[model samples]
Target: MTRHEQQSRLSNVARVDSFSRDTREFVEASMRGDGCLVRVTHASVGSTDIMARRGDYLLHPFPGFVSGYDFIGIVEFIDRPAQSLGLSVGDRVAGVLPGMGAHATRLRVPSSLLVPVPDGLASEDAATLPLDGVTARHALDLLKPSPRALFINGVSGAVGLLAAQLAALDGVRVSGTASPASAALAMQYGAATFDYGDTQWPRQLLDQVGKVDGVIDHTGSRTLNSVVKRNGRIVRTAFGGPVGHQKAATAAGFAKTLVQRFAQPSEVVCSTPMYVAMKRRSYRRDLTKVLELADSGRLKPLDPVVYDVSHYREALDAAGQPASGKKVVLTFGE
Candidate 1:
């Protein structure tokens, strides 16, 4: 069979076992045959179902009742299909996994789905790119904000923060919701921040900024009822549950809107062209801007909280804590 056919077949038949509370044991069993010992470089566990059986070809879960998604890092010792394609040791990769042990020392992954780290970027920093950065880019492409005002809900989240910055760079006037601390950070990135805690935030925004051209709702809650204009666009990223008749009725009046049921990374964001371009130059350019912002004290790299692989359970707990500012990532050889 050709490589694409082989990949198609493998994808159609890949077996995924669901892990309940014992993800470590489950990962050990999954990797028993031909697995590598990849270090868990970085991980995030929120707003996705924690456990599910993942089909082979389709990296996204079969939709049912689930809460959050899990991503993991693993050290690959043996060459696999991904290695043949260019993924390498100490490459620092990240991809969706069956569950949360990704925060541990190492986890097994199917070779084809892994994304390589861009050259000259730290794994800790690179880890933050895949899930959020790629998603933000995709969502913006979908919305196609054109020098207009954009509103981002939950701007403090990883995806939200990146989305705001990307929009601002596109010459869009950006506004976002966050706590006071996160709002301060968002301000430095060129977005006008709104204190969501204030009961009159919606009214304040309407009075201060008027109707927005597009809204990126990361919270997926219907709290935006009064803020969005009748003729504006709304693009929702959070999938709390099915959109019932009430939401359907409310959304019917909008000129253009979309509710993304899943947040999977699009193939467009992971294409060979994008990857090659990133490795050759674009990745460094964008990241250097971020780093320069950091160096100039304009942008902060999400509060530097480090965690060892062994302390993964604690790290996961820390991630769940409120107002933590980004996440506590795993550091190798520390």
Candidate 2:
């Protein structure tokens, strides 16, 4: 096919079968011409993708869906409404979907969900941000009175690293828990790092860094509740547990967790990024701000472990490893 034909072609998606299955080859791509259609260049396989694959994500109850939430791509087609919103054919953009579908070679997404990728940023680097960067920024924004000292649970992870950097840039004293291998990286990003493997780590955090004004808990660990001051806030960046626990996940259970977290007398103001993103409806605004911050060199991008789209299983395996402190990005190369 000619370059023009290829650019205009429909997507070849990474379709997930049932839980814990490898992605099927491609599915037929039909255009409704209702949104901005992009030719995807890079996509990130995050923890949520792993959860969805394990049948752990509540949002992905059914199977046979495409398998990514974040991607960087060039706009191949634009609806009139999307064009009015400032998107155009040939613009390079990055975005997160409310649901799965970004892993495709082509993707149709709402123009409002995407932000223009800065010229200086590479697509691989830009691919790592949309979901995690926005989540970190939004979590920090939820802190009331703004934190003077912040504690991050799981600081070495994707979202945690970004949260640490963003908080540090705001002049907050950041401390966080990480494995021994990743502790230096956490410190390099401006957080005083501790080993989470220690059962007494919370006490260590308090004795060492002192009580924090705010906490961002990505691990869903209740132990983090001890490090925040009485008037401080907490943001729970994720939900569910292991694949076994996720099998038992329910709406009632989710509601109970929310209520229990919120009942902590203002000390724990729980906010999941996906929940907040959907509720606030400010993804485009938040994503644009983070991308601009990255472009301005205020926020450093994580160096991703890149793999071809055909090796998604291997990418997913690498991303699922606990000590893998880098983002796993899949590219659709010629």
Please list the residue runs of candidate 1 whose C-alpha ends up more than 4 Å from where it truly belongs after superposition: 1-27, 32-39, 45-92, 96-112, 145-147, 223-225, 229-231, 239-301, 322-324, 332-334
Q: Extract clashing residue pairs from model 2.
A: none
Model 1: per-residue lDDT, tens digit, 1-334?
Answer: 6985443222111123443344342132223334444555465543232223222112233432222233345444534565564666666555543332343345555554455443455556545454455456556655653538888887777767777877876788889788887888777767798898898888889999987766777544555645655555556554333322323332332212232222221111122223323342343334334444434544344553566646655654665563425655555441
Per-residue lDDT of model 2, residues 240-288, tens digit only: 4656466344444455456665555243333343543475356677788
Best by lDDT: 2
Worst 10 residues of 2 by lDDT: 264-273
Scored by Cα lDDT, where does model 1 land?
0.51
TM-score: model 1 vs. ground truth: 0.62
- The per-model lDDT (C-alpha) reads 0.51, 0.77
Output candidate 2 Cα RMSD. Answer: 3.0
Residue pairs clashing, model 1: 11-57, 37-75, 38-74, 38-75, 39-75, 48-67, 48-68, 48-69, 49-67, 49-68
Q: Name the TM-score of candidate 2.
A: 0.89
